[model samples]
Target: MEFLKLPKRTTGDRSYGLTSIADFGTPVGRLISILDDYSHIIDIAKMGIGSAYITPNIQQKIDLYKEYQIKPYCGGTLFEKCYQQNKITEYLAYLKKLGIEWIEVSNGTLDIPLEERLTIIERAKEDFHVIAEVGSKDCDLDMSISEWQEEIQIFLEAGCEYVITEGRDSGTSGIYEKSGQIKSELIDELIKGIDPKKIIFEAPTAKHQMFFINQIGPNVNLGNVKLDDVLTLEAQRNGLRSETFYLEEQNANYINQAPAH
Candidate 1:
């Protein structure tokens, strides 16, 4: 029976979930080629900030991403530009026309009123998968943990599918320090009040990823992940890669499960 049983694995994995990846900078066909090979593992692809501005052919890449069953969306900064310029309606329509499946609603660069942000969340829910970001791009604009808790509740109620803490692709600044580390006290306080599944830490560095895996387990939601690292992240989450370091007590429990005596 012990031989038949597999090691206890983490949850939220349908064969070790790999939801994020690094940039695909080449021809759209090249991206499709990679996705075709790895579709079983890759779940989401972000084109990253303003990268789309380079070529008119970028829509072809998004189309390929959709065909591969991967949700691709514009970066939060691009959307912020749209939202700040009062082009929300056009931006939403453009995304729909382009057949985009996900959108990141963020107030990272400019100030968006809470009421307006809630409205955007609700509106995005109607047609697209919404991943709402909950931190400022500027480190100086930091809000108290209490404010974050309240903001998260409002965003959840308004229908943001996943609330991503702002790591801004570098995993430095925002909730993390300049050294690219999360403030454990703040994270603990946030977790104490919010559902872990609904919130995503934007962990862009290996250190940050390892830290979050140890602190919150592999079931934690992560965002702004690099495209090439998808498989690696999944391996860490599944306990196949030991660098993330699962809690020893958890390993002890698994070890102690009664073998037929």
Candidate 2:
């Protein structure tokens, strides 16, 4: 296996090249089955928006993810809903009850201003490690790259462990065009002067996955990955997939290898 292993991929608890998989409500046994195989590749199990609220199996899933050493947390949308309903205190208490250790503080759907959001983030830091998200879910709220950088810097300076750009799970909004195409120009400019390691880009599709791997190298942090695609994403990261099979070193700049549009 060493013969074909492309430049080494990071292992164990990692600080970057993170893969966040969305668990849409997998039953404990099935969840365990998936985690048993992919835990090494996955860094976080996000109980995606819808499932985070009403799912009764959250505590069990959280416990299982912890057993595998993967960070488990509910999606930001749940927090958004609680914020909308004015029950943020109750929501934080609920997360603490579930043994959750990480949290996503976002205003993608709620429009909380940067200052207000930062205050909330500071408050949440008392109980959890926070990943702050920027950008709006609607296609209409376009932001210039400079504005994006400004906001990202603010979040990072505010003690957030990482700042995530809003490429919704569909990959068709926020960082992408309405048609689901990656806004390369915007992303290209955004990553300039910014450390990719301190940010997690939500890439939900193969094209999205390959783009970041090639553009930012194998260690680019990615989120919104599907459970089934974990191995393929890891494969692509290490040049194990056909599309990026030619990758042989770190920070692969094989941008020419990007899949056909």
The parts of candidate 2 lying over 4 Å away from their true place are: 249-261
Error of 1 at 181 (Å): 1.9
* Tens-digit per-residue lDDT, 26-144, candidate 2: 88888888888888899988898858778887777788899999999888888898889988899889889888978899988989878878888999999899999988898888988
Distance from true position, residue 75, model 1, in Å?
Answer: 1.4
- Candidate 2 has an lDDT of 0.84
Give TM-scores for every candidate, taking all chains together and pairing residue i with residue i.
0.84, 0.93
Those runs of model 1 whose alpha carbons end farther than 4 Å from true positions after fitting are: 1-18, 22-26, 245-261
* Residue pairs with backbone atoms closer than 3 Å in model 1 (clashes): 21-226, 21-227, 22-226, 22-227, 22-228
Best by TM-score: 2
